[model samples]
Target: MSSQPPEPPPPNPTTAHGSDRKLRADARRNRERVLRTAQQLFATEGLGVSLDEIARRAGVGPGTVHRHFPAKEALYLAVATDQIRQLVAEAEALAASSDPAALFTLLSAMMASGAENVAVKSALVAAEFDLRTAAPDVAADLTRHVADLLDRAHAAGTVRSDLTVEEVMALVAGAFAAIRHIGAETSRDRSAHIAQLILDGLRPHPR
Candidate 1:
């Protein structure tokens, strides 16, 4: 009898690395959708919105939402982390600018964006968010950068040398608090106007 051809080896599910990779990609996509939907809903409706609603909006199941976030607090933290990242990026971009007025303008804009995002602010409070706590080295770096800019303006007789960096930070914090009290759009407009006024007062008078 003719010898039978050796049978091909059976397919191995465990060897399907490509399949595993596809599964991971799908999971990541679902998680991202959940986060995006949650952020939008939270901004519009506040953090009290239900997880089921978030899942429905995201086109994911409740199970998927839980799997990704575990809890509302965790999701809030994620949102806050994202906002911090954006703020850091803006700061880095503005670091190279030579004009103190322009730098202050950019900083004010960034703060306005933060004030607009309700989820971000909630997350910040939930996380006990401090500039120094959220980003350790970043606080010092930013302070030094701002100080340098202020110094330049001061030397040029455009800004006051008497104001400390701590004082500047206090002013920024007050602006943020004011923005929080008013609606974001209103807050942003008012804050920008107020900031300009503060800057004017801070500017040195020509001899």
Candidate 2:
């Protein structure tokens, strides 16, 4: 009888694990792409843009968007959380720098990000989804970073002496409201002007 064919080599566990990791990474990248595309479409095109359209713009299958975010509100919350995480990353970078004015830099970034995500913020608020409660860890991380920067600003005499982190946070929130009140959420220059006016109050004034 003809010799039996050689047995196939055993499966390579290393290759299997590598493929698994790559698949996971690709899924994460697709999810992130979906969130960013949804955020842009929501800000510019409004919340009426469907999940399918977002997938099309993000260059992913509609199934990918739905797989990650099953509902509109879910997408809204994810987008909002992603925005704050970005601010937290910026705060981390600012913390690493020697700039005594880093606090102002971070605050400005926060305000600018808020202006860009105002629509998503409003949607979350309407749906009664507070990020502080929904994603407390990320919210706290940003606040903690802000507090650290505020302490630096105090040592360097960059900001008003008595300005607390709570107040700094409040001012950032107020800036968002002011931008919304004046319908400047869609206008970069207008929003930046409003942000400047709010941020000015944090600086030390003449005696």
Candidate 3:
């Protein structure tokens, strides 16, 4: 007698939400690992590194990596997004400071950090992949943070009032490009020096 399959166990309300939370947490951890591993490999190995290799280094299967990042470009963009987010946070903190020199110094450091991530530097050369266009929200947030910092510096009579926010951003981007020309290892020092030099040009001239 197929005893009515033992009455189905009562549904556990907490079980589903718990499982979902754990799954989301695990996914985030895996995604982070993938990004870190990819950044290292790409930096040392260039964009030629295989997805399988990234997955192996990340301790996840190739399918899992693909599930999170459907293509190589997507993964690269994710890395850039993460880097920009960190830079934006730093910019926000420095925006409140009265010291223009310190603010520019911090901005240079942030660009150096981005340069260190191989994928990010490489992506910089890819014209088809515009971080600002691809990740507008992140870019806008970052731009706003940077603008605020520039405005603060200008208000303090430290920075040039004639330069627009766009001009400052262009300088920052140009700094990164120049840093890339010198290579990532030297980019930090070179960028800081260049930033200071640019800052000199931006400073309010004494009448």
Among these predictions, the greatest TM-score belongs to 2
Clashes of each: 0, 0, 0
Q: TM-score for each prediction?
A: 0.64, 0.94, 0.82
- lDDT score, candidate 3: 0.75
Measured with C-alpha atoms, the lDDT of residue 130 in candidate 1 is: 58
Task: Compare candidates 1 and 2 on TM-score and give the better one.
Answer: 2
Candidate 2 per-residue lDDT over residues 55-134, each given as its tens digit: 99999999999999999999999998999999999999999999999999999999998998888888889999999999
Off by over 4 Å in 1: 1-36, 97-100, 118-158, 182-188, 191-202, 205-207
lDDT of each: 0.68, 0.94, 0.75
Consecutive 10-residue window with the lowest summed lDDT within model 3? 183-192
The better-scoring model by TM-score among 1 and 3 is 3
> Model 2: runs farther than 4 Å from truth?
1-10
For model 2, the local distance difference test gives 0.94
Task: Assess the local accuracy of residue 16 in candidate 1 as a C-alpha lDDT between 0 and 100.
Answer: 81
Higher-lDDT candidate of 1 and 2 = 2
Off by over 4 Å in 3: 1-3, 95-102, 117-127, 182-187
Q: Between the candidate structures 2 and 3, which one is better when assessed by lDDT?
A: 2
